[model samples]
Target: MGEKLKLYGFNNLTKALSFNIYDVCYAKTAREQKDYIAYIDEQYNSERLTNILTTLTDMIGAKVLNIARQDYDPQGASVTILIAEGSMLPAGETQLAHLDKSHVTVHTYPEYHPETCLATFRVDIDVATCGEITPLSTLDYLIRSFDSDIITMDYRVRGFTRDMNGRKLFLDHKVNSIQDYIEPELLRRYDAVDINVYDANIFHTKMMLKEVDLQNYLFKTDVYELPPKTRLEIMNNLRREMIEIFSGRNIY
Candidate 1:
């Protein structure tokens, strides 16, 4: 029978231990007072802990594991080790069982208009299950349903500004996203555009709003407001509906 083992915390460290089964223990520098490695050792038995850590590392496909003492630890340095006995677990089948909650505070820039309180909030969604859909795909669906115009927007990939004929010009273009495009363009107009895009793994979402310089008498304004609780509730409902739609399909 396959052994059922569980290990908690220790981000990439868990994966490293699984691959280097020979390494009995390892240490991770603590960010604050929370020593993750020490915590794991305190929680589980030595043998079971070793098995679980090894399994998790194998499942995640790690290369070499390292041990480091936290620089800010008041109690001094501590090392963690693990031992492996069997083959590693499959990486693909692993699912995120839980997610820690985090919050982002919005601050207005000096140029921001005080009449309109604009705030940018970002929340990360951890994948708890492995299926046909990925986190990025899910985020795309959410963004598309939320705002379609966001997908196609002109942006400045790169370039420099010069005072040509007392006019500020920016060389820009309509690109898919940040990483995918890199070019330059010159513009004689000033406009503010707000954009939101997902990162590579859909692990993080980046939102940007900046004013472009132009020499035209006409001015354009773009504003983005944080969604209210009601809108957020609706979004949650929509996500649930989408999940139900995909779950109902029969692959066989």
Candidate 2:
């Protein structure tokens, strides 16, 4: 745990956490792919996403000032919530103007490849705050909120705040790596990597599930129904898809 720094005034350091979570599935037919996408759209619609963000806002000890959410046509959804420190604001003070600067947002992307029969649903979330409250506390809850197969996260602290003696403090807390904040049990379930710039106060972590249960990745398809050879092929294809996404490139 890092010691709390006694700041000269309100801590203006902006700490932001950005996350990308992916859920992959194998949909054998066109209908299955369409259905998979539709299912994701409904499962994570604006209403649901707003709930998640609001919960996250509470976890970080912030108050939601306003919310803007929309469910897109065909597929996808987006939710944005403006937040402020838990303290009550002065009379006639409006927090709406800070919507663009300090807020929690989430957007979903659900798509599939017709030829490959691989469907992927991606959720991008961002939490930015400019005060004593930090978004790091909500990491565990956010990770467990979705069926994440691969996850990439970036956390950075920007700007500077003054100490009692007027010395500048770039980061109020210590962060060796983003992985340090994740639960050890959760870390054991996945292979994780880190790319951090300590001087710049930037941290990045990417994770991919190490174990694959065939039935879990199949959409409306029974694992036992497929022949042994077919099962092996499906498993390989799924693994390949996960690898491609984890590496952020086409395997070939």
Q: Which candidate comes out best when scored by lDDT? A: 2
Candidate 1: where is the Cα deviation over 4 Å? 1-116, 119-124, 131-133, 148-252
RMSD values, in order shown: 23.9, 2.2
Give the per-residue lDDT of model 2 (tens digit) for 24-52: 99989999999999988999999999999
TM-score of each: 0.17, 0.94
Q: Each model's number of backbone clashes?
A: 16, 0
Which lDDT value does model 2 have at 33? Answer: 95
For candidate 1, write residues 1-252 as lDDT tens digits: 123222222111110000000001111122211343333234333333334333333443322132222222222222232212122222467743322211111111111112212111111112221111111222323232222111222221122233324332222112243323211121111111224332311111132212211111011211223246633443344333323322334332
Most TM-score-accurate candidate = 2
Error of 1 at 205 (Å): 6.3
